[model samples]
Target: MTSPLYGQMMEVPLLASSLLSHASRHFGDIEIVSRRIEGDIHRYTYRDCEKRAKQLAQALIALGVEQGERIGTLAWNGYRHLECYYGVPGMGAVCHTINPRLFPDQIAFIIDHANDSYVFFDMTFWQLVENIAPLCPNVKGWIALGDEGCMAQFRADMSVPVQSYETLIGAQDGDFEWPELDERQAPILCYTSGTTGNPKGALYSHRSTVLHAYAAALPDAMSASSSDAILPVVPMFHVNAWGIPHAAPLAGAKLVLPGKDLDGKSLYDLMEAEGVTFSAGVPTVWLGLLSYMKSEGVRFSTLKRTVIGGSACPPAMLRMFEDEYGVDVIHAWGMTEMSPLGPLARLNHRQKQRPLEDQRRSLEKQGHTLFGVDMKVVGEDGRDLPWDGKSFGNLHVRGHCVIDRYFRREELPLVDGWFPTGDVATIDADGFMQITDRSKDVIKSGGEWISSIDLENIAVSHPQVAEAVCIACAHPKWTERPLIVAVLKPGATVTREELLAHFQGKVAKWWIPDDVVFATELPHTATGKLQKVRLREAYRDYVLPGAVESDA
Candidate 1:
């Protein structure tokens, strides 16, 4: 029964450690620059990172970190954080990057749920560790991510057994060899933002992580290369910083870690000082950087492309970066479930040849799926929808890097074979997929759906609007009506009538909001996405104008 159809090849397992090792040997002199927490610049080569990563592996082993045990890190995008990215998984342990912005109780819940043996944290987050120490029963000890100088403050603030990072690693030798493990073994554990309930974990395997790194570094993906210097403003805690930790070294690109200073001026300073050629982050961070540049009349020297994701990037923001400045905005979309990378918004040759207006619109859609990933939008009857561009349905993806099941959860989230993305999207004839709205956030008015994202996109295009979030308000006639909650730019004088008028003729006449409310600011989740769930609660009782007259 044996057929000769299978051509045999070398069956070497892909490991995250191999990325750093290759970079160290080939691009040893390229600097992995960091703006340290101590408010100073720290520079080291890939060779140095590889050496330190080995030492960190030894330190973890000395601490009784067994294979498959979860080791948590509550830190920023810095050098020490990067060490844990490679070192923990290098020894078959899972590196669980906990977001520091999460509520203290949620952090404790994650630590207890994951049964983390130890947590390595930055000194700036000492107080947060102190607050959660009592609740995190599984964490045996804490290690401060700084020198001996931080021990004084850590000892005073935290009652648990704690030590400095340098002191712990200083006693270890860097001669440890990375173990060869099954490529399917988990390397990193990431949790969703957990807006509704406890955050769920996505345990990424060595094979998937390594594969994602290659996809992210591809010419049409992140386009990372040896000649590029990438600044990952996106924190490592957020889906392994969108896989840059592995992708950077995998491509031999120079890395510039911006510690915790993400403000516009701080980011601008670091990019200029480091000659950062490419970067990636959420829209909220880019807005600040663009605002700073606008106000100060400054510009980027070495920066070129930036990947905008975590949330949808406004078309206005995309145009601003490409038109005003020379930076290319690589609009991207993904979920924590998909190893945080789906279709990147990088354009190809045929699409580039389209009319300028058509090209710009295509750019707004999440780019065509990368080589290894496949996507389909399905309708209510559980059949695949057409790619004619007019049909909107549930978005699902199946790929080499997509998750099979969440960590510790018995339920398999996949439908048939594809992972449901919980997003309503449409894929066009040319394979460009556009996300219309999240399944829960879409508005059904008069038995027809209105896309909140589309409305928000149009609203923000107004000159006075800085940020806008559209939510469904109760409607007496239509059952639900569209209403916009917007934040005006500083010193903005736009009125309710003026802002609402801006939306005219842009969308379906019914798609426009019935009323507009100016807000000083809007609440956001820890991941910097607009908190529509919270806004729904805040405005549940507020009557829309049409409903107000009918109710009276």
Candidate 2:
């Protein structure tokens, strides 16, 4: 007989709603910590957060905000943002997250496109609010998510009615019921990063969000628990901070907020002050923290686990945290469409006997797909490749949480019930998946596909390199060539010849970078992933040997 499916699909109560009641029921005293702009730390319990969410919901309704209307927030990862995550949705309204790092035009477009009726913003986004308010004519009011004393600095706004978030919460009732949801109805709408084209909204339904959150808190995913003092350094505007806010509360994890300031110093201070045990953010955020620790002679005394996603975590960065800092860095991989849950690097019991170095090397792969997620690799012929690690193919995924289509832009390209992730990868016999390249980032040299990711990883492993970027440049003999950009560590120097020599014995000599360009820093995406497109555009006109210079 076929093995029965192990995972169960059950209708649990609304996570936030249940958690608040539970906090009041059992864990009422657990603290939710946040460092606010008032220069004082704010501490509350889940019971308080639940009551405040209800109050916010009541306040929104009293303000003539109706269910199904869009509510937008331009704030940081904090307690207030967490309130909006539940309050708006519980009241049957959709929460649209606007990326603060997006260009002014894009931000305006997303707000207008979502038809947001009200905006909750942070004090730091005052100038951004002023510039974009006129463009978003549908927004009837703006609430600054600040304490009473800190609201004065943000009161100088334009045409919209500016209100204090504290005042609204203080004046409302905290006894509203969350309407029963269709589960398929849109609850959250987040836009794609728009690196290639116009940003399209990936609207998530209540069911998808809830399912993804369940997966996120699983043993292999985030493995969050009530004991985990979780700090999501990822921005709330980006894929629901990789769904951490939703999952953490569902698991009753104590929430720690770093607020609007995410610099290394501020983050480290919060982690230490809050006694955060588990955290999740991109590699760049942790990279800064690692550098800060090195410079200031600090260490992560309280932090025990970290989740690195939004981009591939360099093995060196992972090693630093796991080996040196004594914090486990779980390499995660996902995208906006997957509700950001695809794979996680959880070492099984079998791998525990391996050497630390070997374990680290295995963890660098994206790890096994979660229970609800199913993954496959497809070659150019659209045939599924074996999960044998040796075969590199385009990665395709289909699952419960994976988005079926884009909002307002149906006809999304789909094949055989799977969504093309645009990622190239290799799957080992044991089910560990390693991303080789982005479909667009792969370089074709002399009709052979070269993974720039592999090339850059090798280059950065050199002692002198601090950062690296690999892009395809014009080649006279090969049509397209791989160009490596290297950023040196402080007080370190190496020429192109010296770096190429280091990689000579490791990779094929022909696969080595033909020309190495040194730089002070590498540009990164809003989510902290290396922006290879920017690197390509920045050096588009580079002249290569025996090649003509042409703008890419």
Candidate 3:
């Protein structure tokens, strides 16, 4: 109310400022625990993390890191990563998170593209550090974010000066003052997984990220609270661990970081030990953990809820967690452009009393849009469609946080304020949105779009199938058609005939897969989503029964 433009500018403090402010004033005693180099645990409180981040700020200043400079980090989820999350941004520098899983060339490209001047690495990434060091021209220093023993080889390999993270922090006076930051300044940069085209980067502002964290902590979203110990199985490199690290402190949640080792046993052990009640990740992690729990006879005493996104979770997996393990699994859907937490899959108050099976059916949707988001489905003519569930169209999303441009690609597609999500979806009467398929992944047969996801879901519903991938293969008459590739479960056998028969009553006859191919496994994306593009490439020459190949 002070100024006419004050309404447009939400005068919230910077993300680092808010994170430190909360930790110091309200939840100083909340614990932040990490698994250490030894077979032991290192524990600290929010109070300790705040002090350490300040010490890190002081050390960065001592090392001559200037404002707006890029600082890259290759680290796993741990208290140290958390420190950099706040410390780097607190010093008015952008935190460039390097995904260790990316191909070496891609990794080199991101490092150079960001023009990072300083690098930090965990002990696990020493060899990788050696590999890409030469390509980073602007980088002048290497900081080993681990113990002194781990820094020996790293320091020797680095052409520039190298310092141990422990020694640097120990040497700092911890008397650094926080920098004044404009809320609109870039706080973080995340690149999309380049499956369709070249990877594109999206810059996030301090204000935007802080608002996203607040929205993420809503009851309809992650619903985090101070009493909760949160475990984000999602990687920190991906959309800021879906903004958990930022949201956790704002809500006073105790944080648990499962550094490096994300295997089934390690995650379960950490979850159990830390009393983690809620977690989020892609479906693959939960599947692996479920298998491990059955094989090792391990159970989560505290983990009661999991938020699954990045791909559609198998209904069976959702059922197993809900029915067998007494854990609730909620399916979520969003893109990197939307700051990653766009829609949450939750039943409304009216649907809460529905039958369990009916309830689960509703929960499988991407759920209703969040508070500040708006969605519309557009037809080929760019006209809006009714929310009748049966009317499918390309989904267009527009919001304050939705990205309007890629970092450097001014020519990339944009229509008005709306960003085409490149996803085809159907909105039900109840306002829940269900994604039919990605635009590029849809199979067109006889001029009708067939959702590969729908076919794969049907295929996996059969007891014999362990996993299924549907991709379009060149068709002589139909132009393009879907071929279902199925991976069978152990000791299970189902022929193509039997599987086709399962879809007879479930879907339209024409929508049935033209052919079914048996396989041991389906390829997956770097983030563990099913790699349909690879599947299409592998079967581009698929031959279906009674169809002839054309030279044209």
Evaluate residue 384 in candidate 2 and report its C-alpha lDDT on the 0 to 100 scale: 92
Deviating ranges (above 4 Å) for candidate 3: 1-14, 37-39, 153-161, 549-552
lDDT of each: 0.91, 0.83, 0.83
Candidate order by decreasing TM-score? 1, 3, 2
Give residue 358's lDDT in candidate 3 (0 to 100). 80
lDDT of candidate model 3 versus the reference: 0.83
lDDT of 1 by residue, 1-552 (tens): 545996677767999899999999999999999988888999999999999999999998998889999999999999999999999999999999999999999999999889999999998898898889989877888999999885785577567778889999999989988998999899999999999899999999999999999999998889999999999999999999999989999989999999999999999998998899999999999999999999999998889999999889999999999999988999899889888888877667888888988989988888788766899999989899999888999999999888888889999999999999999999998888999999999999989999999999999999789999999988877888888999999999999999888988998888879889989899999999999999999999878876867655
Worst 10 residues of 3 by lDDT: 8-17
Each model's total of backbone clashes: 0, 1, 0
Error of 1 at 518 (Å): 0.7
Q: How would you order the candidates by lDDT, starting with the best?
A: 1, 2, 3
* lDDT of each residue in 1-552, candidate 2, tens digit only: 534875565656443345445654576777788877565678898888888988998998998888778999998887888899888887778889889898888889989988999999987887898898889888888888876678666565454567889998889879777766666677788999888877888888787787888889998789989888988898889999988888877788888888877888989988998889999998778777887888899888789898998887888788778778899888989989888878899989888788987777789989989877899999999999998888988999988878888877759757888999999999987799999899999888889888898888888778778888889987877878888888898998688889878778777776877788888888877667788889888888887755653333
lDDT of 3 by residue, 1-552 (tens): 387755676555656567766866799888988886434688999888888888888888888888888888888888888888888888888888878877777777888888888888887777787788787777877788876776675566665556788888888766777777888888788888888766778888888888888888898888889889999989888878988989999999999888777889889989998899999999878867887898898777998798999998777778888888899887888888888777788888988998987888888788888876789888988998999988999999887777778877767566766889999999988888889999988888879899988888888878778788888888888888788899887788789899888889878888988889998888887778988888888887778875774434
Q: Which is the leading candidate under TM-score?
A: 1
